[model samples]
Target: METFLKLFENPSVLKFTKLGLWILLIVLIIGFLRKLLKKRIEDTSVRYKAQKGVEIIGYFLIILMIFMAITLDDIKDYTIIIGLFTAGITFTLQELILSIAGSFYIFFVRVYKPGDRIEINNIKGDVIDIDSIYTTLMEMGEWVSSDNYSGRIVKISNAFVFKGPIKNYSMDFPFVWDELNILVTYDSDITLAKDLILAEANELLSEYSQKSKTKWQEMVERYYIENATIEPTIAVNLTDNWIALNLRYITDYKLRRDTRNKLFSNIEKTIRSTKGKVTLASTTLQLLKIPELEVQLKNKL
Candidate 1:
């Protein structure tokens, strides 16, 4: 008991003890406020922002307490030394610092938001969450077709925004131009096939064109972009074995797969209803002639 009392009597020990108590009290108060804020905030995004701010402030306070404890006198004399130390630490953690900066950029500049589909450095996905150091993605189109999710969640460094291109599918213009190619045999009625495809695409995608036109107009007004035709179009290409009719149309980014499926089903039904008028093309190999063996019999008579 005497030794414990003597230790407290020392000025250095007493100062440290007071500093420790203050740190503990600050941490408890900050934690309590964070919990209260989380409960009061209804929106998850707002809650997340509030909690992050509290965490950053808490860290700063703890760091300040440590500095105060270490250097109680002549803080001005140590300014240069602290600045050099900070520079070294910043250099070591440059990537981390950049990621934090990226998070702020994402928040303020609106590079992307949760639920927006984006592709960065060939990694495409829907944004799941934007964190301080990482951006979470529900991955798409690795082994799957037509922007469908591949059942994988990927976390990429937020600093990737500074590294490569960022392609957003559903930003200002939420519609994408997709194509479906139908090949018909040479003997089939090419004109009739083209008419049927164009008719089907127009009927199925008429509503999409209307919706895209409004969104596209908004995009034009917001950015320096030209107005484009959002209607369905048909282009014909003559291949070696068949005539390919390409049906191009605008569709919502999320509904690409479903729209394609419906369009294909309708086109199939329409073509099949034509009986033998529109014959689907298939690859065929024809053997013109087997190599003729010229056997000149040498008669040694």
Candidate 2:
């Protein structure tokens, strides 16, 4: 008890204790503010962003307080030491520094926000969080097909923004052009198949097609973009086996698989109604030669 009392009596110890108290107070205040923010903000993305901003500010304040407490007497005398230390830290944490810079770049350049589906480094997912070091994604399309979630969370380094391309699915326009293909026999009525595909796509995706057209027009006006076919259109590719009728149309990214199922089902019904006019194609196996096999007698006999 005497030793503890003496330690507290020392001026340097007292100063450090005061600084520690101040740091604790700051931490508590920031925590309270974050709790208040959580209650006030409803949007997950916005709430997270605000919380991060508050945390950064709190860290800066804590660091500033520490710096001021240590350098109260002679900050100029420590300048060279500080410079050298900063340089060493910069060299040691080069990747970390780059990631921080990339975080700033992502925020300022409006690269993709939380809730946006993005693909970077060939990794496709929906952005869930953006922190100082990493961008967290709810992964999709690994073992799954057509933008379906794969039940995996992926954390990518923010520094990757400098190294690769990022494809955002819902930044300016919230629609994507998707293609569905059906193979029809070479002898089938190619024109009727095309017409049937176009008819089904137009009927099913008419709302999305019209909305995407307006969005594309807005994009054209805002950016230097060319006019595109936003409506449901059909293109035919002649293959060795069959003619591929490709139905291209705009759709909400989230509703792609559902839309495709509806379109395919509807088109199959429509084609079936056409009887033998537009027959679906399949691979035909033509045997050039047959191998002979001999039967063996049973051992039990």
Candidate 2, residues 55-92, lDDT tens digits: the string is 76876788799788777855586688778988998899
Q: TM-scores of all models?
A: 0.77, 0.80
- For all candidates, what are the clash counts? 0, 0
Model 2 residue runs over 4 Å out of place are 1-28, 39-46, 59-76, 287-301
lDDT of each: 0.86, 0.88
Residue 170 error, candidate 2, Å: 0.9
Off by over 4 Å in 1: 1-76, 287-301
Best by lDDT: 2
Question: Cα lDDT for residue 281, model 1?
Answer: 82
Error of 1 at 271 (Å): 1.2
> Pick by TM-score: which candidate is best?
2
Task: Tell me the deviation in Å of residue 163 in model 1.
Answer: 1.7
Tell me the lDDT of model 2 at 58.
78
Residue pair clashes in candidate 1: none
